[model samples]
Target chain A: MIQKILNEFSVNFHFYMKLLAEHIGIIAVSISIAVVVGLWIGILISKKPKLANYIISVVNIVYTIPSIALLGFLISLTGIGNTTAIIALTIYGLLPIVRSTYVGITTIDPSIIEASQAMGSKELQILYKIKLPLAFPVIFSSIRNMVIMTVALAGIASFVGAGGLGVAIYRGITTNNEMLILVGSIIIALLALVLDGILGIFEKLVLSHKLKKIGYKRFTAVIVAVIVGLTTILVTQKSSKDTIEIASKPTSESYILAEIAGELIMNETDLDVNITHGIGGGTANIHPAIEKGEFDIYPEYTGTSWQIVLKKDENYTNDKFETLNKAYEESYGLTWRGLLGFNNTYSLGIRKELADQYNIETFSDLAQFANQFTFGAEYDFFEREDGYKALMDAYKLNFKKVRDMDNGLKYQALFDGKLDVMTVFTTDGQLSDSRIKILRDDKEFYPKYIAGFVIRKDIIKKYPELEEVFKKLENSISEMDMAEMNYRVEIGKESPRDVAISFLKDKGLWRDKDE
Target chain B: MNKIIEYDSITKSYNGKVILEDFSLDIMEGDFLCIVGTSGSGKTTLMKMINGLIVPEKGNIFIGGRNIKDENLISLRRKIGYAIQGNSLFPHMTVFENISYVPKLEGKKEEELSEIVNETMKLVGLPDDIKEKYPSQLSGGQQQRVGIARAYANNPKILLMDEPFGAVDSITRFHLQEDLRSIHEKTKCTIIFITHDIYEAFKMGIHILVMNNGKIEQYGRKEEVFKYPKTDFVKNLIAMAKLS
Candidate 1:
């Protein structure tokens, strides 16, 4: 089972590593931030009895909130994916750090404090030179505990589409792939254990000034530097490709570019567009990448470009596409090419047989049967401005139940007939392949998402021909073509680039002679 | 010599019980005043008030003519060296370090402190070989000597000792009392000594205040307090010393 899991991870090593980096990064950042903040707060509170009591009570209360629920609550505000997870884990790791700091600082001998005071040391000087040094052992150990909790909670965060070993583990569990599950579990456990051991040595160093005499600290530093250097070299060496990297979220347009547009751009333009997939909270993960010139191009939706990207919320009809295009052009220092052939709205998806049998052709018709169906959805779909919850409230549909499923599993569950219905991305290629029929929102419950490749504002100035490349892709791949392309890559187990190339050739956008 | 300390109408209580009421005293600059009181008679509490370690409920303690308050506490405490039984010589610090602690606090450099520590330890008859040893490894008598060494390190104007010889053997206690007399002659530090043993008090104390309950039953020169025995409390205390 372990071998099989290892093999599975080895096969999708890129996906797992990216996920590991993000989850572990958030946890690392959060814990460090928490330690610095918590230690100071703990020390401050130790000095002030009344303030300490109230801060401790607040931390205790926050700690009592379940990790998963807190992540969900955070996701409601920050949207789905790793950023939300980082936020939740940061908050959860505070209590141990705060409490330990408080206990440690307060427990120092009163005589020591008196002696310091008698020596003409001010409160601040005594705290740093004496109190903190005395409290170092306790504080660092609490941070060790926080690190462990951080790794564990970082895994939980991955359930909200926050990539980490958690995503791999959850994916393996849902698919009943024991090998994948073990791969994620073992790696995560190993990471935590190794980090814990490192912190153990750190705690010893802090407590025992004698360790400085032994040269053990210098030895540890050398070992850490070597390990980090070797890991970075190993990861970079493994991803050998004639690669053109494009950073993107795994949304509808993202899949289209990865499964369709990437190959087209590469084929006609003589570039190898390596689609480095990521999860998105709209332009948060992509726009900055474009501005920093980290990515060459990505398929960003028009509605997001309008409301989420351009920072405008004025309501308009489908004709607002021109307004969005003009706004992107005027404000964002980027070109907005014309749309992809379809409108990817928030589709109410159900099992095809159920939809056909019940004659539920539209969201209004489906509302009458809502009490009998449980809807599964991504965390953001329940909270986004144009999310399913807002749509549900607008249409007054009282569903029997609502379940939040991770992005990777929501569609799989729907296909398995485990979920009665789901709020799905309109451009998601899964809707076509899984044979799940989507109920039309006859009341126009969501805005139109016209897919287009968004590049850095300066890319146009760098390469004027990029505009021609986007125009060639405009209205070329329809909804059905995008779905077939996703099936070929995701389900057929073909490389996403291969799938994209084959589709482009079949569409005659690129000929065999072009390569 | 001027008076180094004065306790005026100093009253004390613990948990609604009066332990010391209207207690008063004056210690001339170099006087070694031993306050002899039985256990629970508020001798320790009175000594603590004199050092500003404890505050009196209804009266003031003037140390170098300044009332014990936040404004004068640090300087007042630095000038008064205090030691309790078990020697409370910081367990983690070596004897040398313990002796040099107060001098260092008074901003004395290492050269000056080292000289003072060695001289103080020698004056108390602590051997040079045990200078680096911690208090825990030392004998009961040695610990008490180190305690005295530390008290005199800073050249304080006054020293308060609470039952300093109580923890040592009788022979050691007698020798320590004699050492205290010679050390006091050399340093001229005003010592307010608290002891339950009336005989030791009479021998060590030039002036004795025989205390019972919360008030002084007799106060006069050591010979006079012992000879007069005015109140029944003082007489009983005198009788108890003879029986012990």
Candidate 2:
């Protein structure tokens, strides 16, 4: 799997290089802006000592907000891409820089100030000539802290079409391709290290004014120039203005479904269609964009929209599709383009070897020996209302221990025998390759989370034939087809677009217009 | 000689507590005047008020026969040289830069400022090589010399020194006191020197002004202050200096 990932990297080396550059470029621009402006604010507040606490308190509040949520909020104003990313990252970057500047200037010896005043120095002259130079080291150190944070946070910028190495990481996560995740993570880490190392040199030079080393900043600048140059190439490579923008949550099934829709539309019509997934905050992030017409469509689960969006409880119902249809149309002007005939509901799974040992085919059967089993699940599953607690309470099963692992790592832990049972989505690509046996929900513990398209209602109306052509996807794909498609992309080393196109082609929904 | 510095009914407070309340005084030209007071006695406030570093809330100050309030503060400050204790020199600037700063701010040419820096440094007995060194590299005595040189850079007519030797060792303090007295005699400039030490007051000042709790305890020639203490604060302060 690692070799396959590396092969993919080599094939897309230029693209990856450009993406990493854009990532660093975004960081460099945002951080520089933050330092300059944040310092001014710091100096301004320092003059008014009484206002310092209030200003910093407000900035501290901004820092406390989640970066992704902040980005989503900023989208309304900045309207997307590098501008929005830079703005959000700058806000996060300001807190430390401002605080440090304030502290650095305030802490200078009063005698020095008096001496300057005695020398007939103007207030502005005193600040620039004396205080700032003395305060550089403290301020730079704080800026270093902010740089590291901003680099990491810039990964979320990919959601609003801000291209960066985050694209690879997001792709890796959504497809369950661990090697891609590792590759993207390593590059981002290296970029941060290089930038920080350069900053350290600048800090040192500021303090001692010594020629300890030659060409340190120049060398760093060259590397940055190269990254920026390559990034420019990759950014400019974006073509196809005539495109329907489809968005998806960061999930394997969602990505595949969106790709399938895009493939079908591009193949059947003269119009172009493309998917931009890995959106932050999953449904919460994508839903607003779709409402604002920034995105045209995405695949959502019925259970999620019902529980999260409509605020429903755990009562299972067959009339869910009708209620969701009415609410979405009236409230959001969105259309539920019917189910894809697959129910990717939540399930509990154990290694087949362990299941055989315990003779557990159903959740009720596992309940007797539940005390002997150790469970692992994702962080979201632990918090969602219809998640772990509900399932455990409804099933009346108490496991020996429950560990909250990452979504990707959960299956790996179970496979390694670290976990006796783990959470699984029925349509997960990994389930096809693993010897994991999903326990049947004999007690009907989970509500149906049927997968289908949630498109802007206007798009369906504007392209009336879209409603008919899309409804053809209703009851079309089965559970096996979804699992197979996910597996092809996840383990078979095929791209989601390819897997989707192949599936759509086989279903006769994708064909060249000439053909 | 003219009253180069005249403080007229100056009242100032911080957080509703007055530091110098309704105070008035006159400092004559060419007099090495020492204003002696303990901490928070508003001695520093009197010196700072001359340079307009701290402003009086109620009344006006006249420096060199001109009302300080009527003139541009920047030009006023340029003509009024001020110095303080240990950290008076800027740590980031070299001795030369620190000394030349006042001259530069007065719009003197760089070549002229260099001459001023060297002449002032020589006047303060600082070595030529120390001009290139930062204040941090200087010894306590050297840093104090740089501070004095910087104050005299623009050749101000009235110079203020607030406990200038307070932060140095006894030996360094004695050396600095001698250097200051000689510089005062040579320059013939009015000096408002503040100190809590009675010994420094008597040894340095030609005239002594003693203050306590924001009011003048005694103002007279050093000989008169020594022979007759006008207030209990002055008597106790003099007695304490004698004991020390």
Candidate 3:
């Protein structure tokens, strides 16, 4: 285990360091915002006892809320992204800061107050000089605890689409990769340890001094350092455009496809790939990641790349491959590496008996009794215009209820009759194995298309060889062949690289062991 | 010739128990007036009322003919030197800072303030070098003297003390009383002191108020209160205290 950990450290040392630096920068900004806002509130509370009571009560209530629920609540409002993550973490970090500030300032001995007042000092002067100074130890400890919590909460922020070490852990969980999860968790723990060590040194220096000499100079210095340090971290952080990251959606099928394509290109070509999974399927996040230079390449579905990204209705199909090919290139400044010969089309799927019993031969057939049936769909499909939701509106079908299910669980829901019909990808290997029947779109409202590799327009110009590799894969595999490749990786527990090589050898695209 | 302090018809209560009803007193300038009473006799409450720390629920307190009310309460508090049984020094501040506190609060120049602090420290018999230390480092008696120096620093016209010498050793208490007398003579401040020790009151007070329940049974010169014995409560207190 140690050797494995050491090997990971040696290989991805820079990656983890960069990830650490990013987490620190983000967390520092979050904690600073929390502290400033909390302390201001704390000071206000100190002045108005009743306001303090209300704010403290609210913060205490917020602290009791489950972290994931809070993240989910924010995601609904802000959309899944880093802003929601930071805001949620910052809110969680507020309770200790505000409570400590209140406790510390209010608990100073009343006699000291009498002394200050008898000295002709004003109320404000006494608070700043006597009350706050005496309360320093307690307040500082609360801030220290807050810093630790900010680090932990910031890691969880990655769940709501914030990128940090937590991304590695979440991806690790979905893919069942223990090593990746361990590394991510260790980095977070170390970040907390390092922060505590720094603060511990600070606490020692502060408390070691003659408590009397802890006047405005020392107090102001600490505040100044915190402000300057936070600003420096934020100002000097790497922008999205400066580095390359590659993320894929759906932990199983699409991710494997993107990984194989990325590995082939990154090995045969010169670009790098980060290969993250589960960021809402298709070209939406990938397109932006590439445009922002966070990712260099990802596999995107044709209908999604066309209908949604290109903003064209299904009518403009001069050719399924040719129209999408031409449109994406011009519109997104991306090159559609010719089709990989797999159409992961959105099909109206149901259990074989349900499909036969209802005599649902076409999507229009379902519209007659659509209000009586419940549909189960992957969360994103409920919203996307090119997704099952849009097709329902295009064909004027209304379902009794549309429940969101995880990608892996939707098929199970169909088999169990929990869903009357679900939107499933046509090319999912489980469709044939699970005995699910697909209904035809007689109105041609649904688009038939292949999923394939997409790279930035600049990457194609930079590495001309990428076009040849994508072309080779396109010619080498058909829809059934691609489905079989996905089945081996997804269910057969075979690595994508092994699956790719086996497929390449069977098709005579790759040389055998002798070569 | 000396009339720096007086409390007229002072009445206070807590939880419906009359503690100091219809209490009246007077202290001349430079007079060390100690009102001796047992615990809960309202002596501490009366002194606090005189300094506007606690207000009488009934009756008015005139400090320099300005009735002690909201308008001049804080200003009156600043001018009345105050100390309590708790050697309640600001823990974060040094001995010197706690001593010079009042002078600084009055916006005295730092250089002159330091000099005045040094002079007061010497008068209170606190070592000049102890100014650099914090209250936590000092002994109980030393903390109280720093309290005294802080109270005396403002040079207020009236000093209100509630069992100020109660926390120290008898030797330290005697020394503190002597220091108090010398400081009062030099500053000409009227002192309204509270104590349970009748002997200490007789030893130090120009006038003594023997209080029982809520009202004063006798208020007269120390010699008169000692010799005349106006009330049974006063006689019993003197006999119980073994006051000669």
Task: For candidate 1, write residues B98-180 as lDDT tens digits.
Answer: 78876776679889988998888888999999987877789999999988887777778888888888889999988999999
TM-score of each: 0.66, 0.76, 0.70
State the DockQ of every prediction: 0.13, 0.59, 0.38
The candidate scoring highest on lDDT is 2
Q: In candidate 2, what are the lDDT values of residues A1-515, reduced to their tens digit?
A: 67865887797798688788778778877887798899999999988888999999999999999877788788777665677888898999999989999999999987777677766778899898888887888898998888888888888788776768888888887787877777888778888898899878877775775532454467668756865675466456445566778888877778888888887777666667856767767787677778888788899988888877788766545576888889999999998995798888888888999888878999999989999989889998889987888888988989999899998688788888899898888888777755798788888778887888998988877776677668778988887789889889888867788888888778877666654
- Candidate 1: the clashing residue pairs are A5-A179, A244-A274
In terms of DockQ, which candidate is strongest? 2
Error of 1 at A16 (Å): 7.7
Native-referenced Cα lDDT, model 2 = 0.83
The local distance difference test score of each candidate is 0.73, 0.83, 0.74
Write the candidate numbers in order of decreasing lDDT.
2, 3, 1
- Interface RMSD to the true structure, each candidate: 4.3, 1.2, 2.0
The complex in candidate 2 yields a DockQ of 0.59
What is every candidate's alpha-carbon RMSD to the true fold? Answer: 8.1, 6.8, 8.8
Candidate 2 chain A weakest lDDT stretch, 10 residues: A209-218
As a TM-score, model 1 comes out at: 0.66
Q: Is the docking of candidate 2 incorrect, acceptable, medium or high quality?
A: medium
Residues A368-476 of candidate 3 have per-residue lDDT tens digits of 8788888888888867867765787778999898899998888778777898888876777666554677777777666766677777888778767877778877745
